[model samples]
Target: MSTSPRSTTWRTRAAVAVATLMAALLTPAAAHAAPEESTPVYSYADAIREAVWVDTGLDDDGDGRPDRVAVDIVRPSEPAQQGQRIPVIMDASPYYSCCGRGNESQLKTYDAAGDVVQMPLFYDNYFVPRGYAFVGVDLAGTNRSDGCVDVGGRSDIQSAKAVIDWLNGRARAYTTRTGTSTVQADWTNGATGMIGKSWDGTIANGVAATGVEGLKTIVPISAISSWYDYYFAQGAPLYDSGPDRLSDAVESSGARAKCAAVQRKLVDGAPRTGDRTPLWTERDYVKDAAKVQASVFLTHGMQDLNVRTKNFGQWWDALAENGVARKIWLSQTGHVDPFDFRRGTWVDTLHRWFDHELLGYDNGIDTEPMADIERHPDQWETSSTWPPSDTRTTTLHPARGDRPGVGTLGLTPGTGTESFTDDPRLSETDWAARIDTSTPAKAGFVTAPLTRDLRLSGSSQVTVTATPTTRTAHLSTVLVDLGPDTVRNYADSAEGISTLTNRTCWGESTAGDSACYLATRAKTTGVTATVFSRGWADLGTYASPDKGVPLTPGTAYTLTVDLAATDHVVPAGHRLALIIAGTDKNLIDPPADTPTLTLDLARTSADLPLVGGAPALTRATTGSAATAPSFTPLDSVSAPGPAPRIPRG
Candidate 1:
């Protein structure tokens, strides 16, 4: 064929294009290409909000059929069409339809067809567009799920586990509550990550402890690993009726009679004596920490008197013992969320964490420091590991003859005896008063003014050899930081973030959920002394949490009280005070009769988890005592009260 010059040029161009196309297709990069990262893959407006009832194989409400847990999910509409099998970020909570989630008390808003229009909190609004599914389950009985609210018992844990099973095609799920039409999660990659705070987070811990197949990671903030620790402290009841109150608060089905039998079981199982039973053992995730396959990212407030630092401390220790992959964030705010405390950093870090865990993005989050701790209000520092990795346990013995009502804390134990009567009427505030002034109800021991700053990173143990006048007596101990300072008061709100007039956006917004949330600032309060840690114990239950060992009258016995864990820095010139008293009126129910506690001071000592080299303690100058700083009343300075009934957002 005779070709013109133009025809030859066109033919050459086409041939070159074909060669380039074939070469590109044959390259390894073409086969293993990364997903486009310029913009999010899915549309938030087009997200699906549907319910699936997963069979739990138990008739928890006494019905003949198996109880199916109601799982309300919001995810990208075209995950399968996008050629991406998305993973799930599930938050199975009891608060979806009850007290709500977050600081605004946001509930699940629904559309006309009874579909969930708004999934509470920013999880759905933020992660759904990133090509991930967000599932919010109505744990067994709390919302639209079948069965009773068994608290942290088998039903609660299993109900959430069923949803995980359904995601991995290991359990049965239906499109409707009673519909026979089967629903499969074919679009899901079967890797799930759970995250939540408080009770919602507790569910995550419980589920992960079951060693579920597809659970990839969990971010449990301010969660309880042991329900026994939540309600009782070494046989001392934190509240008079802890389990009963908690069960009543989460039972949202309105048909109380339906779960009356289950409710009674919880109450009966949780005895007032604060002894560990099989019921508590079932709820104790610590016991089953060996089964956890998921990497954990835990966050908790050192000042959280509600859930308390012990919950996280004990859990953290257990996870470490099991050699589980974990990261932690310890804050000064009480029961507060990291999003509120560190806001921008928290959001960015969380996004990276989710991307790494759920989307399989190599974000290098695992290579980063494993622990982030708040040294002061709004001040944070990262460490290679929790408790600073170099923390040392230093023992400080109580010495007498320093001052009445104020004993010296030093390395050498002094000979003498200090007697204090257990007064049922004394509160923590009353014990604070006895620190300087002589009082028969409490014995106070203070370290001399520290020459250098000393930081404590973990729990402190106070062991006292004492003789009680009665067999049963309550021992309340507090670790106090005596220095004039201002700190974030977390005890005021559930999340420790007070709602403000300002609003800030975290991610994209949709018709159902907003990208913006009300701005929050840490509530700050000034104080000369703050209770760094506190622990209560019923002496009768001292020997074992499962057994009561009454003390013989006038017989000296060694009792150890583990104070709440803390991350606090006692500045130079400040003293660390240990207050040993009777019952803390604000926390525990007092014993019937008052008993005198005679402490053998030489045998009494406290072991502190010091973060650095032990600082030298200077003896008090005898010439003239330094005037004490004007102190803000402990009540005036916000301290966490009883546990809030609401879940974290």
Candidate 2:
């Protein structure tokens, strides 16, 4: 048929459009656009839920067979449906059946048929829908796993490492504890990013230190790097107990008989003498930081006496020296999970972190700020690097004041000596409270009020020269900020954040598992005084932590005591005090016969990690700092011992 000119033009346009559509369908870009959903690319409610027993090469229970750890997995259904694979986010925790996980203490629940009905926490609920699998692993010797608890030792680490190996096709996984039917992780892309809190997170650190090839990244929250530092601080025995108690506590469902011998081995290896034995060395992840192939995303509390800030500080330092990619969040809470204190933001940030690290998404997450610090309650600030990347150490000395047991900290060292006898019943709070008064337990020294704000952004130390009246003495030193400020009421029953009745959902949920969680708010209190940092050391370990040499009576020894790491800003017009004390009761077991220590003021000094060094400190204490605005003065936190709770899962 003959067509008009306008009809011919329309026919020609239609032919070109058909050709364009065919070409676009064959393009790689169009293939990627096949899934048009905005994330939630997979179905959480219909995910493939399964379980496996990964065989670890060690048998700590001496059962004459290798131990097999239980791993419960939930991956998106889209992997099998659409023929796509995804990475994994694993939380290998011993608390899966015992004490529970996260703030609400959620545990794994199973169906009547013995299949995993629910996985605890928001990880599976949130990440599974976003094209990630969540694996809740019962660490060997806990839950349904067949082994003994080695605490943070070889068996404990290998239990989780075996899971990573299984994913990478390097190890075998079975359908049952005693079955020969093997299961392969063909649905997974073999990239793992382990994340957890407390003991679970400690395993992540250990596994990463193993230089495992499949682990892409790790998010360790309030984790321990060294078992030695956990039980003792610089040779000062901080706890009366050891790993034996922790190992026994998490061996859920009464399989304790098998682990009894392992517990005894733990106690035997970890002596009360505070010496770093082979047991502590094996548990220490910081030494193997160079072997880590995965990028690290770490979070820790400034006032965390449980896992403590030293663990993060030392581990972060080691990671930095080894040139490992890392990011961090420093909170103000005490021994809390970021999920409880900063839930919504934490979930989102962690999602992005996992996406960028594991999924190989060039999302510019690594190019962003490396550190996020909660300076005050619910207030946060970001930086390119921690300690502002410009920090320097400034030395402040204790000078004698007119009153006995009261002194001043100055740029110049003071002559003469000051003495204080040890007290067995006092905590750091008691000594901090009586800074202005004369006390036999402690000698306090204060600096002139700062004229401007001064930030302390890293670890600090005190070099002390003292002569003991007896054969041995314990030394405890603290840095206190004597001014008004608002701090988290760690004194609160809940430890800083109180849970609210309100709830919010972060992702899609299943019938048995939830993406919703109770809200939490920072419980704050106005305080005139707060302990910024403190440290303790036994005189017997003065020469070295490896050896406990017998101290000579009336003999002088100069030793360096490293304080906990922190990021705190001393406001203008606030005085920084240094307290010299003995036996921070409840923190360390006190000796029956306490010794008196004579401190040579001229030979002692505190090395502070100041953001701007001496010049900034001089400007802050000299000029405009005097008349600066201040907060309302109130009582400080009246807590018991620094760490009254156990740090185990």
Best prediction by lDDT: 2
TM-score of each prediction: 0.90, 0.93
Question: In candidate 1, which residue ranges exceed 4 Å CA deviation?
Answer: 1-39, 493-496, 613-649
lDDT of 1: 0.77
Instruction: Determine the backbone clash count of candidate 1.
Output: 1
Give the candidate number with the greatest TM-score.
Answer: 2
Clashing pairs in 1: 102-649
Task: Encode model 2's per-residue lDDT on 140-205: one tens digit a residue.
Answer: 889989998888998889999999999999999999986889999998878899998888899999
In the predicted model 2, the residue pairs found to clash are 451-620, 451-625
Candidate 1 lDDT by residue in tens digits, 440-547? 898988765665677778788998888899878888888888767777765465434566898898657876688798887777776667777888887776567586
